[model samples]
Target: MDPRISKQRTALVLDQPFFGVLALRLKVVEDASCKTFWTDGESLGYNPAYLGGLNDLETRGVLAHEVLHVANGHCWRQGDRDPKLWNDACDYAINPIVLEAGMLLPKGVLVDTRFKGKSAEEIYGILAQEKRQKEKQQKQQGKGKQDGSKPDAQSWQQSASQPKQQPDSTPGGSSAPQSSNANGANTPSANPEPTATPDAAPSCGEVRQYTGDDKALKEADWKVAVLQAAKAAKMRGALPGALEAMATDAVEPVVDWRPILHRFAQESSPTDYSFAMPNRRYLHMGLYLPSLNEPAVGDAVFVRDSSGSVWDETQAQFAAEIIAVNAGVQPRRLIVMDCNTRVTQVQIFERGDAVELDLLPVRGGGGTSFVEPFERLEKEGIRPAFLVYLTDMDGPFPDEAPDYPVLWASTTPLKRARKAPFGEMVEVIC
Candidate 1:
């Protein structure tokens, strides 16, 4: 069994109060393999990731969450994933549990910080900031009653210098939210900038995704070499040498695999059952940010600097590029990085469903270091044919963008930088 995934299929059935019940077969999987529904049976499938890690508490929590999904009939929800319906379901099912479990959350559940536009830490920071802002307003209002005028931003900031209070909850079936004093708890919430424009911490980046499984690429060097050579030629405005390199015997070898596959499968299928056909399709996963209305092909990379903050811009622009392979195109692949200019992770987005843009890590709101994207694009083996970014262009970037043809689109006004890189620049309302 793969280290990242081991599962036991359950035989349990469904009932009225619990949408379904399941039998247990224990399996072990890698930290990474938790992405899919590793456990499946007649009634429903469960994602072990929900359990985060397999401690007793997490195991129970995951089991409970899955039970909730079954009970709510989320498995049978007719339509696809959309923000509204999904959020509503989470409110009904997830919130109550989280509120009740406030302090003793399972260790692994929240570890993988990937959300729509903010990192786990960044999102938490947003919560902290809101709390402080509210407290400031309360004190300012109290002073205003003694004098005359009302509280303002400055008064609120002054009040923020003081200590703060905290809320508590108990974990039974559901913890009833206690009504606290409005003088401190409510305080009119500082009017909140009209329609409560969200103070987004931000989310960012799509890892470089290759089209084929790693093993397939290893067995198909010639095909992949040809593809890479073509891209190099286009990028450098020269083709003859690259073409010659592609035609070489070693790096571009084409070996038939009929015998090799028979050796591996051990028991061959009946000749009549063996049938196949082939065509060309491709996909590239880049920076997938909700801030943009388009697609992306930029890898999420960390940068080098004093602060060591991972940069994830939701709005970036790309021109002169687009889809050219399946997310699992055997020949292409995605790369990843962290904030300290070190690579933290690299996973291929082979399956269509694996390409998640709304996860917290990529869109986590933070100052993005810009030098990494170009360095990634210029790497020797990469063959991505297009690029796009959704960014506000608010921070530092590399001295030069990659020479490969590119497109630059910014979702927000060029806030702090001259402009982002690309051949074409289009301003978007989103």
Candidate 2:
């Protein structure tokens, strides 16, 4: 280990343990061929000359930058995309975060404020869109010249008078010129520009593509490590406010709610084997086997929180999933109940009847109360196979868990969803 790198890692450990802890996970190796610094999700590679050019603060920043690329899973995220562009997008997404931590990155590194709070995927979309648009414009210009058509006077003058912008080297050690257009248009020059030399490029570092069979395992390990680092930082009162939600998400990962909803419905439905009705296919083969029969998924109750907290779009999405699940399970009846403090509207769909969202009544703008739906179910003498409640889980709960299984499809933070008195809780991402 280089003494300077070792000293800065220690400095990070004392000041920013979250970054410091993650930084230690990457084994540092000096590579003369490396332009500056880079990480392959597991190890950090750097050129000795790069570190020697930076002061202590900038060196520490470079280390944290690489650590974040690993911690944020950027290396494993570039799937089938142009590698250079993906690297640029990842740099845009994380550079602001590094700068916000009050660490100094060497000048000329990619840092676009436009992508400050966006994820790498989101930034990639914008960059990809810009690239496509620019390519289209260039293609049109080329066609015009081939057709012997002259460019408009203003357009020709603008092109001739505009000073050529030199390509700026990204932290990834590749030359990607920063867009000078105020609108953030990243247009490449039609003619190739000279690539920046290694010595002249910024020392902000690079994130290499993670190409290994254990990508999922590595990603899961990083998530757990992030949670642990966050805990350690929190204990020392050093956790950044910007990272609080990220840490919380690490603690309770956000997953697609559709599969979870489907699983809950499937598990809660009744199943039995009947010897009276032998399997016809097996009977033809002279093998007498008991027929496995799944009873019609009995009445499924869907309770919607209509207390003005949940968005209409979220309800529509939840309703669509419920209908899809119902189609799969073929429930005998689907009872849609819109409730707040009390059950406001009820729409029941009997077996063989079309279940349509347009027919379902939407009502209620009162306080939230989970007790009303249960009370209504009891009053109607309708014992459902399962009940799915879509809410923010910011309401009063029933005194006891009901006999029937309950699945809270909550549209709140996982911490709040965990407060549900009973049943399984899955975060409903809107």
Q: What TM-score would every model get versus the actual structure?
A: 0.25, 0.52
Distance (Å) between predicted and true CA of 40, model 2? 1.7
**Model 1 agreement with the true structure over 369-429: per-residue lDDT tens digits:** 5455556556644534433333434445568655444434343323322465444444332
**Which portions of model 2 show Cα errors greater than 4 Å?**
150-203, 250-279, 282-430
* lDDT agreement with native, every candidate: 0.31, 0.75
Clashes of 2: 0
- Residue 192's lDDT in candidate 1: 26
Instruction: Tell me how far the alpha carbon of residue 51 in candidate 1 is from the true structure, in angstroms, after superposition.
Output: 57
- lDDT score, candidate 1, position 258: 28
Candidate 2 positional error at 107, Å: 1.5
